[model samples]
Target: MASCTRKLYHVHGFDPRQHLEHYFSDKPDMVFEEDFLIFPIENLTKTFLEGHIRGDVLIDLSLGSMIHHLYAPSEFFKNIIILKVRDRCILELKRWLNTRTGAFEWGHATQLHINIEGKSAELQDKEGKVREAAQHVAKCDLDKQNIMDPVVLPPADCIISVFLLDCICKDQDDYVRYIRKFSELLKPGGHLILIGVINMTYFTVGKDKIHGFAYDQDLARKTVAAEGFVIDKCVTKKATGISDLVDHKGVLFIASHKEK
Candidate 1:
């Protein structure tokens, strides 16, 4: 199995370290440019935002490399917000959103944040309604998106669910749950910009082994549609150097919007 995995890596010219650094770099410009798979997402997002999604809320569930884009605001979203429900890093997001101390400026309409690692908590407003929470929180699983540590805001106009599926979902059923969580956050007709690795991605994130679900462009579209979303645009591109240390081939997804 290991040899087969290695063969697969060479067949695809996968280089894990480079791929990981491309998306995790602190500097946005430092993002990996060689990989064409991610470019389509950037292009598609820019294209969709040209004039169609002005003033819509953008909720980033996975704050990995995607966080870099938040620095450069796009025209599609009226507000760009982030949610980190992981126990250890939850404070990092909270501190980022707490602009009152001049630490970091959201510049957007509002910067809402929460950390639910220690408590069995749910986000409820004054009305006692179980507001929308982090839908992709994975725990004690080798392959899942762990965001359950915090319960953030309710559903909004848009939710940007990035490579989260690779981390939080293992099968189609798990995918359904994650998608439902994201869907609940949006009002009718809300928009969603989802990005995910289209193939199995397994790598050593530090000392822990993280496994990704085998994703493809077609499956992505089907999953999105199953969640009551209309596919507005879809893109797929080739990936390079993603099988060595962090074995992930590439990313592909569609921009879906719920109809009112």
Candidate 2:
């Protein structure tokens, strides 16, 4: 039921409102009932407590409020790093995350947001608004096939590469490369927790091709396992229902680091 501000940014002759309504509307039903700080479903928090990880890094690709909303207070990791493609969705997501205008700042302010969505007027506009506030926002477009780039931040104990796989990739190779970069961003024995939509029929975000990556779940699982990650859990369940904003069948992968 969260209202999104992306409806106003649509290009001419493109009314993806209905399409997007189905896209943005559906969410994890547990989202509202579970407090991320103490949520049991989060494998990262559970792994951190099991003494499997210890370090100064928690890279959050596709930086959105959901992950932070769940893990920020836990401080399970020392430093949090965020990466995202520069699009209206991410920009809106960042705005919601950065709106800590209360009397106190609860979490550490060491988090960073790297803008990796290539160049476009809409993307430029989204970045322009957030550039001043996010000190570490980077200018790289994963859609342009630059997934092998080096990590912009230091190594971390865990990398919560959630919801980014569906956004940053246009094909299998790009998806593999992006996951490699995500792994490279972490130190060995670190963890990776990823969530993405699988078996999606189609996607369109205001005249933009935002959802045509042919999300091969089996191939993706094999690829991540090949990237020195141990497959702890891969859950593919039908969401209880569809959302009016966003539409797609989805899957989740919670991966841990392999001891080399």
Candidate 3:
């Protein structure tokens, strides 16, 4: 199976601005509110905040925005390194992190995080925590044998990837190939948090429909297990209804670790 070409992804898919604005809002039409933010994101925040997992370096293989980690309990990981796939995504993140103009404001997401964690008004402080933890935003090439090339990174204590596997892959085998590649960054027994839209083949952005390899929970588990990870947690966010923005019946969150 072949991976989706990078040129296609850059041209039509993974628009950093649209991705940020659409999925990180509180509105019911926003998929984040209806499915993603409530279950998968909230579960992740609560689990990490509760001290269920501990780590030093958290490697982000998610090419999307860094808003997910902004809500997480920050004390566990001393630093975060986000490995991005596209240059535009990196620029978007850097713009926001540096507080530059034209960058989309993620304060709304931070506020939503505060409400979910039941914290008192301290949105800016939490934003700082995320920024502090994120020490690097480097470009990554899943096409490479070493995703982090020329500069090898120490195996990370935790690896988190959201909504990336399917889009970059052509089929189940292609997805597993990349999964195995990224897992190399994880220390043995380190945690892996992967979130994806379930049973989705393609998604729309503006006038274009970007393609993705559709997958379900069964294949998700089997593939990770084939890589020697033991699943510890699984959470699914069922879609309330259908929409053109995304085509998925549910979202799945998986927390697992390689066998030590």
Candidate 4:
């Protein structure tokens, strides 16, 4: 007799519209990215303003339907290239890039960044900066040796990724392998900024649960270091455990550079 078997859940990732509605709601309390992801970016911006992280080409890796965090970097970088894995995300982002209709409200994120970094109170100016700086938005192939296959994306001087790889990568090895690919996009000594939830096994979008690789600070530190990345700094923010919107022990921010 054949045995009954249960299939494992695959993390194909979440829909951009549902994700936006759930996480980026009008109620500030419901907004997760604005609260958790923006501060680390503020710190990055402060360093850039002080002439630390320099670059003409800044590559944003697999950022799904969210462009608010790029606000601070836009002021420093000459060009910004956004790459994504899914077609739905690309369409959502393109809608905003083209005309701003049907786009998730990003003004709060902009305001948060401005409040933290004092970039500017003018919301339109901040959005305009990022919109203007985003030179290209195209699909990426993380499975390939050259992830940015078609464009031959100019070796980035700095690359930023947030809450991207963890969900898409099926296992810890997958996570580490993609980091290597992410590093390959950088020029010698180029910086890498990674932001994600610590030990997050899954996140919820609507009624569905999106699975992700589980990891901690030690794993993060060891993997990046093992890949020959010089760890510049690491930061963490404690989660309040107030909401089950996503189950994460905490949030971790990592900054490192490929050795020169």
RMSD for each of the candidates: 11.5, 11.0, 3.3, 3.7
Task: Give the CA lDDT, 0 to 100, for residue 257 in model 1.
Answer: 88
* lDDT minimum window of 10 residues, candidate 3: 1-10
Taking all chains together, each candidate's TM-score versus the true structure is 0.63, 0.60, 0.90, 0.89
Candidate 4 has which clashing residue pairs, if any? none
Backbone clashes, candidate 2: 18
Error of 2 at 120 (Å): 45
Comparing 2 and 4 on TM-score, the stronger one: 4
lDDT of 2 by residue, 1-260 (tens): 11222221112112323332323333344222121222223444444446655565565665222333233213344345555554444444444446534312212211211111122334223323433333343434443434326544566677666555664465688778877877766677777777665655344454443443557568878988988898876656544335432355655546557555
Q: What's the lDDT for residue 239 in model 1?
A: 66
Error of 4 at 107 (Å): 0.9
Colliding pairs, model 3: none
Against the correct fold, how does model 4 do in TM-score?
Answer: 0.89
Show model 2 residue runs off by greater than 4 Å: 1-51, 63-74, 87-94, 97-152, 204-209, 243-247
Global lDDT scores for all candidate models: 0.50, 0.47, 0.74, 0.75
Higher-scoring candidate on TM-score, 2 or 3: 3
Q: Rank the models by TM-score, top first.
A: 3, 4, 1, 2
Best by lDDT: 4
